[model samples]
Each structure stands twice: as structure tokens, then as C-alpha cells.
Target: MIDARRGVLYPDRMPRFHRLPPMPEAQHLVAWFWIPEWDLGPGETSRQDVVAYPALNLVVEPSGVQLVGATTAATHRDLTGRGWAVGALLRPAAVPALAEKPSELRDSWAGLSAPDLLEPVAAAMDGDDDDRLLRAVAIMSRWLAERAGEPTDAGLQANAMSELLMTDAGIRTSEQAATRLAVSLRTLQRMTHRYVGLPPLAMIRRRRLQEAAQRLRDDPGIDLAALAAELGYADHAHLTGDFRTVLGMAPSGYRQEL
Candidate 1:
């Protein structure tokens, strides 16, 4: 399955990252809950970067909590000391329930606004940073597990569009995606930009780069040429360029880090 936890464009950083299954009832709206921690020895520093996924994230750190919107570019967070975070990765099509429209949160991380989800989570958080995260996740699971029911309407439509862009490698252009979604290019653009925080074609490109990063991280020895073709790149050179665009390095450079 595609990794629901996006980012980490530089696998060589050697930070600890893990994904745990979300509550069963919340699975449709949440991909997984994740906890990542890093403790660089004294005088050491590490930078973790990711190209980001087209999903909202509710992140809780020792300092505070944030409702992060979909990001449009690769980003990095530099860490110098011990730090950790608990994050809930939203499903592609699900509105954060916190935002009136997902687009309203684009390129931003806001303080908790979804009372139904945040109130319980914050009240339950306490103790050590990791403990606070664990407690928060437990509360989150319960909250989502008991919600009215599955997502509907626009949520379904947004998710369907996202799955098409991520899983169907043949789609590489806006016209192709608009046809596949059976909507006019203009309509597709509007819906995706509003719902996914990215234009339809940009979402497709993001997924491709996201997947390429994971594949390289998992299997450093994989053939770049073959991988390029599998990911719908026109050639190895094209793949290299795409990787550079999203990750700041070519596939070989990333693999070398591994």
C-alpha cells in the first residue's frame, strides 16, 4: 500500500518515524496516526524534509498542537535537540471537519479549531511529551470511532479523485485527469484545488514524487530507469528532473544516502 505518512524526502537523516493504525471507525477519514522522535547526540543536528501529501494533519507537539493544511512544496524542519510529535494524517478527501473548506487551510497550520476533535484531545493530554501524545491519540481514536458515520458526498468525490491521481500512473496531465474524473477541466480544477488544497495535476505529480521517495528509501538497490517507467516518467532523465524538483536531489544521490 502507498505510505499514508508522507514527507521524509531525505531518508539519510536517520530519524525515528513510525505509523500506527488509526481507530477502526476512523480509518476512512484517517490514514494512520504517527509518532516521530529524534534525539541527536549533543552537538549534532539533523534536517528532515518532505514533499508533503495532499492531506490535512493534526499535529501535537510538546509545545502545542496545530491543524496543518495541505502543503504545496517540499519543506524542512531543523532539529537540534530532542523533539517528538504525534500527528493524525487525514484521508485525502475528508475535510478536517475543523475547516469550513480544506482550501482555507492551504499552506498553513492553525491552532485547533475542530472542537469535537480537539477539546477531548487537549483535556486528555498530560505527563511527558510522549505520554501526552499517547493520551491525545487515545482520545482521538475514541472521538473518531464514535462519530456519526462514514464520509459522504464531496468527501467521497475528493477521495476518489485523489486515488485516481495516486494509484493510476497513466494520468500525468490535467486534461487526462479531467477526462478520467468525467468532469470538465475547469470543474475538476476547481474541486480539487478547493478540496485537496492542490490543483488536480499538481496532486498527481506530488503523489508520483512521494512514492518515488518511499521506494528509494525502502529499496536502495532498485533500478532507477525501470522505476521511472513504472512511475510514468518519460525517461530516466525526466525522473531525475522530477526528483530534483521535489526532493532537491537525483534518485542516485538519495540512494547513496541510504
Candidate 2:
């Protein structure tokens, strides 16, 4: 399972959230599917803070469907009343078909005219049953598979680039990622920009920052300097700068909020 809560800053404050594996039909196009259902009383709202993963998301809400682009920094959303959202965290192979220029869509979203994808999933979500979420996800997955079709060779290469940059803790630089993927530095740069809307180094940094935040949250007694070194930051100050820039808070201040 993908760590559903890894990108989420404060899980304690989240509404009912479920992260599920993508259906076999959509595995190449989607990393995972996520759904968050919330029901609040009058005047109540839940604020969700997230240091989102470096990927696009196709989201289905009651009102409509939207293509959410990759985010460069931490972001948050406010939920009110009764609502739920079903989202697919898209893979690199699936990007080109859905978006023309991903880099332009950074830190934002656009409404999609995909009622063929939305109507059935929405109906499934509206059901009153134990299997509603499952049914909805399956419907969404099938639609994505059909709409995106199969990825080409270059698309698969983009997928490989993202995998290396986001995982492989040993990869701390774009050059290292290119070497591992057997691609030129320029190719790596173009692939990420075209498919992911972020640079290879940015993806690497996001992964490191996410891990640092998780460590601070999970192990309060952990030493900051040591954690920074372990995650390949040059020093404590580098890690602090990342936290301050992306999350808008210092490590200690984040820990204090817990």
C-alpha cells in the first residue's frame, strides 16, 4: 500500500480517508486511488494540510470532475458540510493523454469535460452499501484505462524516471537519477517537465522533505541534525530551509503543533 498518510501533514485531523490499490486494468496509469468522506454539522469545517506527492490527480466530486496538477509545495483544503471525493493519483505514463502541458498546470487544477468518466462513478458513490467505495473505484479505474489507452515507449521511460526520483533514497541528485535510468540529463529534464510538471531534483527534494516531516512526526525524540544527514541534506540548516520554505514552519514548530 502507498502510505496514504505520508503526504498528509496531520492525520488526526483528517476525515474518513481510504487509500486503495488501483485495479489491474489501470495499474500502469494510476499509482493508487483515494477517497475521503466527511460529514460535519452546521458551521463545522475540517482543514486538511498536505505536502502533496509530485504527481497529478484526477478527482471526482459530487458537483463535477477536475484534473488536479502536481504541487510544488505544501497545500491545504477546507471541507465543509457533507462531502466526499474520489481521486486517482496518476502515473507518468498516463499524463500525456490527459494533459497537454503539465508544467503550465502546476499548483492548480482545471475542470474536465469527462462526464463519461464521472457519471457512473458518481452513481456508484451515491449508493448506500458496504461496497460503494469499491464499486466507485472500479468504475473510475475502468474509465481511465479506456480513456488513456496504453502508454508508449517514451511514456514508460517517463514512468521509470519518476520511480527512480521518488524512491531510491540513494538518489539525491538529477544526475544520479539519469545515470540510474540510463538516460541523458537533458532527457530526464524534458521527461519530468512534460510528464510530471516538476524537475527531477524537485521530485527528489519533495521525497526527502516528506520523509523528514514523517520522521519528525513519528519520532519526537529524534535529533534534527542527524535526521538531516540521514536524508542526504548537506546539514541541519539545509533541512530547516526546506521545512521553512515548503511547509512554512520550522521543524520544532511543526513538532510543537502536534
Candidate 3:
């Protein structure tokens, strides 16, 4: 239930965060659903940092629903009051239904006009009972199934491309991704641009960066060069450069903070 520390930067200080698997009906559209609830006293604030996954998200709050695009860098949010949000980490098959030009929406979010979804989700979160979250997810699942419909042939191929890029450590290059997916380099690039809003190599680099950060967080005394080599980087400097570029700090600096 509690997803805890995959993309999270600070596992120890995270508020109440839960990750739920998508219902069977919506599996083609959603990777998973995430809920985070936080309650803080006056004058207190909690800042949550994340190396976000390279995918779009459909988020619902008390106010409304928003379609968030794939992020190119690390992100942080400051929580200052009592609140919560439910979000679906959307798969590539679902992107075209929500955003026609995925590249145009990169690093930004647009408001979605779906009052039918907002009402029941708000009602579910109003209660403190345990099953309320599940009830809310079920409602969202039905909505997504109706809105996105079924995947097309190209959409299914795009989904496979995304899965391979995110999960395969051997896939260090976009050419390799294209080869594994049985598509030309041009086709792979086109598919990712249309469905993922990012280059295939960017997705691979994101996965490697997330793994590097996790390894550093879990093993403070581990060798940096070894970590970089394991993650398919050229050397320690390449790893440090990636950290500084995306995380705004060097790997050693980040470890010191932890």
C-alpha cells in the first residue's frame, strides 16, 4: 500500500504516501495510482523532493483534476497544511486521449474539465475510514476506461517501447531500445515524441539516475565509481555531472545531506 521510496528523495521525512495498482479495466491506461496525505501544524512545513518518473500523470484534488506532463528535472513541493491528492501515473496508451501534443505540454500542467470525476473522489476522501481510498480508485478506474477507451495498434507499440526503456538496464542507448522493440530509430523517436513527450534516451537516463540515487541513499559508503560503472555511465565524473545537472548537487554533496 505505502509506496514509500522509489522516486522519493527523502524516505524518512515523507508524509503519508500510498501507491495503489490500477484496476484490471484500466491497466492499459494507468501504470499505478498514488495518494499522499499530509497534516502539518501552523508555522510548520514539509518539502518533498522527487526524481520523477518520465511519464504523464492525471491528478485529482479537492479543487479539480489536472493533467501533468512528464518532468525533465527533479521536482519539489512544499506542504504547508492539511491536504491530500490522488493521481494516476498514466501509461503511453492513455496520453493521446488526454493530451494531443504531448511534447507541447512538457514540464507543465493543464486543467481538465471532469466534474463527474471530482465529485465522488472528493466524497471518498472526506471520510477517515480505510476503504475510502480504494473506493476512490475504483471510481477513477471506471472514468478512465470510459474516457480513454481502448488502445490503438501504435499506442500498444508505444506502451511496449516505454516499458522496455524504463525496465531494461541493458538498454543504455536509444538505438538499442529501437532494436529491442523491432522498430527503426526514426519510428522509435517518433513514437516517444508523440506518446511520451521526451526522447527515448532521456527516459533511459532518467531510469539510470533514479537507480544511482537509490543506491547512494541505501549505501552511503559505497564506491561512487563502482556505482557509475554499474549504471552504465562512462565514469564517476559522468555520474557527478548528471547529479549536478538534474539534482543541483554532486553525488558526494547529496550523500552528505543524507
Candidate 4:
């Protein structure tokens, strides 16, 4: 079984990410609940660079369901007091089939503005029973499967490429990617935009900035000029300018916050 906990980052004081082992029949879906330490307020809006997945996330504690998107990273803050969250991950193609539009799903099932689904979801969270949450996930899966059908191999490939564009540091150019895929540059660009939203170059810059942010957070001592060169920026000034544009803060300011 794939490790459901791998993608999650839990602070030291909280319970480790928890999940029921994947049953053979339901390997396509993974469900889990997390109760984070109540000490930190939500962190700054970290730019999550992810490819769009055709999945729905139900926030049980506050009660809501949202269609996940690829446009930007979801913002998160540390919550104080004990709180609970349950999330369900589904195949990517299932998303469009399940909702009228992607934005509609986000509107219906996220944050303080959730649909009536919130009440039951919150109730399930408050109770110790797993049946209710499991049932909800099963119902959603069945509904999506009926409408969306199973994911296609092409769709999976597209999704994989999209993820690599956003997260993989080594993937730097369309020419390099085309060489790997044995396709023309034009073909790669078109396919990437269709699946990943942003073009290859834009995605590369975004990923670099994200890495820079993480580095700043983890080590305040990284010199700005060296950091710029490390990320492939032409010069320190170029890095400074781009960092301000993407993060709304200077590199020094960001480092100080660490």
C-alpha cells in the first residue's frame, strides 16, 4: 500500500497522520483524519504548486466539500484548540464528472461557507464512529464513478507530467522535457498547458520560488546572491525582484520570519 502519511507534514506535538489501511477494493481512494497541534495560527499563504486533480475534499469538522484545483496552493493556518479534519482523495478525472464546475465545488464545500453537507459531516467528526465518514466517501466515489467513469491512462500521464512540472527541480525546460518524451517543443507546451494550466517556463519559475521560500524558512543564513545563483536566477537583483512579485516580501524579510 502507498503510504497515506507520506505527503502529510505533522508538527512535533500532534498525533501522527492517521488513516485506515487501504482495502484491496478501495485502493483508488484514501481517507484520513488529522488533529493538528493548537499552537500555531495559520501560516502565510504558501503557494502550493500542484496539478489539478479531479478530486473532492470534504472538510468534516467545519462541514464542507471542495473541488481541488491547480491554480494555486491552498492556504493553511495553525489552529488553536482541538479541531478535526477528514479528507478524501479520488482519481483526477472523477472531479469534473462529480460537479457542475470546479469553482462550484469549492463554493459549496469549503471554509465557513459550506453547504448543508456541513452539519452531517461535523456530526460525523464529533462522533467516534467511522461508518458515517466512510459511507460519505463511498457515496461520493460511486456518484463520481457513475458519471466520470474510470480514469484513462492518458489522463494519468498528463497528471503525472503536470505534477513533475510543479514539483520536480530537475525539469527546467520544454526542450529538455520534449527530448525526454521524444516530442516537439510545441507539442509539449500545448499538452502541458492543457493538463497543468501554466506553461513550462512559468511552472519552472514558480517551483524555483517555492524552493527559495522553503530554504529561507529552514535556514535564515543563506546569502541572497548565492541563493539566486542556486535557483538559476541571472543575478541577485533579478531574484530580489521576482521574489517580491511572487511572495509579496523581500528575501531578507522572509528570512527574518524564520
Give the runs in model 2 whose Cα sits over 4 Å from its true position.
Answer: none
Report, for all candidates in order, the number of backbone clashes: 0, 0, 0, 6
User: What TM-score does candidate 4 reach?
Assistant: 0.60
Residue-wise C-alpha lDDT for candidate 3, range 109-209, written one tens digit per residue:
99999999999999998999999899889999999989888778987888888888888889999999999988899999999999989999999998899
Each candidate: what lDDT? 0.74, 0.90, 0.89, 0.51
- Candidate 4: list runs displaced more than 4 Å: 1-61, 72-84, 87-124, 128-148
Clashing pairs for predicted structure model 1, backbone only: none
lDDT of 1 by residue, 82-181 (tens): 8777788777544545566777788887886456665556555435555666566777766655652567777777677777877777888989988988
The segments of candidate 3 whose C-alpha lies over 4 angstroms from its true place after superposition are 1-5
- Pick the winner on TM-score between candidates 2 and 4: 2
Can you rank all candidates by TM-score, best first? Answer: 2, 3, 1, 4
Error of 1 at 230 (Å): 2.7
Give the least accurate 10-residue stretch of model 1, judged by summed lDDT: 122-131
Give the best candidate by lDDT.
2
TM-score of each: 0.79, 0.98, 0.97, 0.60
Residue 254, candidate 1: Cα error in Å is 2.7
